[model samples]
Target: MGEIWIIGATGRAGRNISAGLRAGGHRIVLVGRNAQRLAEAAATIEASGGVPPRTLVTDDPLAEIAAGRPDVVVNTVGPFGTTTVPTAQACVVAGSHYVDLANEFQPVRSLLEMDSAARAAGSTLVTGAGFGTLANEALVYELCAGRPSPIRVRVAAMPVVDGLGPAVLASVVDAAATGGLIYRDGRLVRTRLGAHLRRIPLPDGTTRATVAVPTGELEAALRGSGAGDVIATSSEVPTGRMARAALPIVGAILRVEALRRTVIRLIDRWQLTPPATPGEVSWAYASAEWEGGETRQAWLQTGEGYAFTSRVAAMVAARLAEGDARPGAFTPGALFGADLARSAGATITLDSTTKDLR
Candidate 1:
């Protein structure tokens, strides 16, 4: 069995991913900021017939993690706003395959910044093993199938419209407040927030919304897979009547460090939480034009973005343990085709002819 190390084991996604690994018969080591949470997570993994992992909690997290020597590292840590690079480095030193549920582009850039180092270490690094990156990258790959020319693609995600977690909220705020990475016209462009918005139909046929978020995968995929013109959307601050009302003020409020802290506190108190269970469902769509004047549509409508991502991480890890994977810092779409990814468990649907948009 492969030795799996899950960092941030105290969080919701980490617990579920640990269980998923346990069910698959991998030895699990739970890592958390607190000793008690790590111990608790280890107990649950053991109860599920998994060999309980050694817990590592210390002030020096990176050094502690490097010593573990795990076979695979699954990090469910959030606010990966920072800390991604060092974590990946620890895995590299340990000679382990590294993966994370990172949804933001900033951390992804930071984590993969060590491409040459990771290659030298013979470690395969995977990011956004979570929903946004997982779904969008996989969907874009499928959308380009059967196309002979440059393809224009758009991608987005809408969590069930209620609200989101604090980490998620912080990310949204960061995206808006910082106006992250963007690429266009064959050049890397970093623009301010809400530069563009479009009306895209949901699976329910209601036109929701779409905004651009930074994407490294799209750039990598375009270069690696011969796709052209990828218009990727990152996670956006929720917009609607309520958002339109509050965002300008929120933007102004978030400018002041004190006011921003207060806003986050109030949002947490309101507690607008998602489900406690692991299977919170999310939907994603990708579309593009192919040869012979045809449009192809492919989508991943799956349960709990994080849960789905965890499984993807497990599958990638199992392949590594089985010695069947290629090594390098490559996007998921570059590593596996749309067909393979779909068979792996994404509810991937592809259609060459689409009247749906009409």
Candidate 2:
């Protein structure tokens, strides 16, 4: 069994992924800033009658990772904007595979851009191995398979998360600070934070409001479909007119370096209440259009967002540990094909006919 290290092992995502990997017979090392919390997290694994996990309490996880090269490292820390590059670089230096559940545009793009370095190091680096990027990017891959590069592609992430944590909120704040971005004629363009608001039709004959946001899904869609024009929207943001009008101003304020850091610090101490469950279904949608007006659409149906993210992250780590991935940087769907989503308990439906693609 491969030895896997989980950074931020005290966090919800980290704990879940650790349990999953351990159950799958891999040795786990729980790494975190808090010795007590890491011990507690390891205790849970031991209580499960699994191999007791090794706990490493350190303020500098990157340094530890570089020193003790595990087979794979799973990063559940955020805002990934700051953590992704340094952690992935540490993995490259240690010749260990890296995986993270990052879905921000900057972090995902930055990680993908390290393909040459990761390949040279003979280590794989995976970003966005989670609900938002994988769910939609998989559909984009499916829609564009065996077809010419599409002229336009639109993907929407509509995750229904059951709870919120301080880290998740911090990530949201980081994304808001990024404003809105879209690929137009194969170029990244910035716009208002809540621009391109649209209502997405669901498979259940309902419509949900979505607004364009700067997310990793946009970059993943662009790569998956080879589309010159790509837009990534999400139902996770506020969609009301007042909220939309205020988003740009809020984004502008958050762009200030000092203020953003202060806000994130405050968020770190927040005791957020878990949100009421949104239901059993979360959906991701993608549509692609060709130059001659031909179009294709697909939807991915899954359960709760966090659950799917944990599963996807664990699955990616397991595969990487098994040496199944090539030496490069990639998003999950790009590296493993669209079937990765299907294997992670998601069902894909295509077009108005609702043909099951699984």
Cα lDDT over the full model 1: 0.63
For TM-score, the strongest prediction is 2
Where's the lowest-lDDT run of ten residues in candidate 1? 272-281
Instruction: Please give the TM-score that candidate 2 achieves against the real structure.
Output: 0.97
Per-residue error (Å), model 2, residue 87: 0.3
Could you give candidate 2's per-residue lDDT for residues 157-201 as a string of tens digits? 998987967887788889999998999999999988998888888
Instruction: Give all TM-scores, in the order shown.
Output: 0.80, 0.97
Instruction: Count clashing residue pairs in model 1.
Output: 2
Reference-based lDDT, each prediction: 0.63, 0.91
lDDT of 2 at 206: 91
Could you say which candidate leads in lDDT? 2
